[model samples]
Target: MAKANVKTVEKAVEKVVNLPAGEKIERDGGEVTALDAASIRLVMQGWEIRKKIDELDAQLKSINAQLIEAHGAGASLVVHGVCRASIAEREAVKITNAERLKAVLGFRFTDLVKTEIAYKPEAKLIEMAADGDEPMAPSIRECLTVGKSASVTWRAEK
Candidate 1:
């Protein structure tokens, strides 16, 4: 047996994309080629499966909430001779008044706080300054950095 060449494969792929509706190309062993139609169909099927999975997940969450309400938190239970489930408790802290709290507990507050500097371009401010508008602010006008980024995206045609 001989291996297929890259050019041959590319041509085959191009042919597949340009195939007319209701037409299919097959390999030697009656295997269907992965053409645009098959690819689109698979994508649509995957979306449908994702929707069903989301629905099942919501139902499971509702059932879990009911079970937790009936048995209380941290109660372990077995179901279907396979699954074991339990609801665990966790604690979280949110700082409502950082400035006031820091004033009250000076050194201790430093332990809980993190500070960092981030650099970003102010394009609009730069443009305004370029167009002869009043300087946005003396301090920021001098400190603003300029940069560019490029990205690519793909979408299906409507």
Candidate 2:
């Protein structure tokens, strides 16, 4: 990015981060931050923030359960006009036994159910194909797409 754009971003961050509590700020959609730094301070700061957020989220789940137990579903609580908590109820169906449901539904199964397809590589066929000594089905080989993915993990050092 241009020097002017980078400066503008720094000024915006300063303004947002320095905002007073109880004030709301709307943010627009954007990509990752423009600059990257090798500083250990920034790396540790980000990891610590992530850990704190995760801890708070877990705590909130337990608190939410307690609220539901005390007030029951459809009960809403307004907290000092700042926030509200409610358990929204909805009906959703899940098939517990696929074979049993299919048999029970009979001809109606095809009309009611939607099918999902997935593929996994066959290790024996792949090995044989690699050696070029045994014949492998062209249909099976054509269905396979080989690829790899990578990810990064960060945690507090003990």
Candidate 3:
């Protein structure tokens, strides 16, 4: 795995030390003389922030997996229903629409499911949602509708 270029406590301290004089170097012991000491607080804070980010990433991955599974199951049910409706009612048009839906919402969705989904490209749906409009699937299906757009918040869903 690729490591992040994080500024550790030591690095932070080094930065402060390297800076020209006339700048304040406040520390708990009434001002720090060494770079290592200066970095102590900053390093701890950075570590905490990194830990939180890792935890959030794990949670997000789990949620994305669940969403992908749910979407897959939903697609399967829809497909089965379309097959049954087509056979019983002989509604070829409905079958065609169902096939299209499967291709778009089911098959296409799998490709989009991932650990992180960004939605900047799906500005239309976001805009609609911001405008107090209900953002349904088909409305935003064209733009990164799968994993790329899956990382949405509870507020966005509501």
Candidate 4:
């Protein structure tokens, strides 16, 4: 019986060895061969996985494009204020025009959609002398002191 089993195995090996590497071996019984069936399924599964990955890649690219567009339209401002507290200090240049300030704040200057300014004195005081004229407010000096930082937000005009 051992010899017979060895002969049967030898015949099976001989039958497979002559055919191409990937070609299926003929069988009489209703049974599936592992290698042939697995290769076909692998090919099909790989195509499906590639298709899904392509769809996801397209979606990611669209989202990134939108983010780039939004970032271009809006940006953050960093205002650095330098303070010089000296007995004799040069006058501070007040930024009165909204359009000019807006240009200074951003790389690309454009007309302002709206302008607003909040100050402690609540008035735009140029200068004064002796007499009953109101003395210059300390806050005005503070505002003029360069290096003293403050940030004002404004919408960019379309």
Candidate lDDT values, in order: 0.52, 0.51, 0.42, 0.43
Query: Which one wins by lDDT: 1 or 2?
Result: 1
TM-scores, in order shown?
0.48, 0.46, 0.27, 0.25
In terms of lDDT, model 2 sits at: 0.51
**Model 1 over residues 17-126: C-alpha lDDT tens digits?**
67554424665667664446676666667889999999998987778767767776666666554566766544322334445544544664444344335222234434
Order the candidates by lDDT, highest first. Answer: 1, 2, 4, 3
Worst 10 residues of 2 by lDDT: 149-158
Q: Pick the candidate with the highest lDDT.
A: 1
Candidate 3 Cα misplacement greater than 4 A, ranges? 1-33, 36-38, 73-158
Whole-model lDDT, model 1: 0.52
Error of 2 at 148 (Å): 38
- Highest TM-score against the true fold, candidate: 1
Residue-level lDDT tens digits of model 3 in 1-158:
12334546557667666654433467665774544444555666788999999999999778656655555322222233232111111111111132333354465433333223321322333343235444345433433222323332232111
Kindly list the per-residue Cα lDDT of model 4 for residues 1-158, writing each as its tens digit.
99999999998777656544343445776554545544655666788999999999898666545544544323443233532111211333443443433444353222212234531111233231112354433433433323222222333332
| Per-candidate clashes, comma-separated | 0, 0, 3, 6
* Model 2, runs deviating above 4 Å: 1-38, 117-158
Off by over 4 Å in 1: 1-35, 112-158
In angstroms, the error of model 1 at 26 is 27
TM-score of 3: 0.27
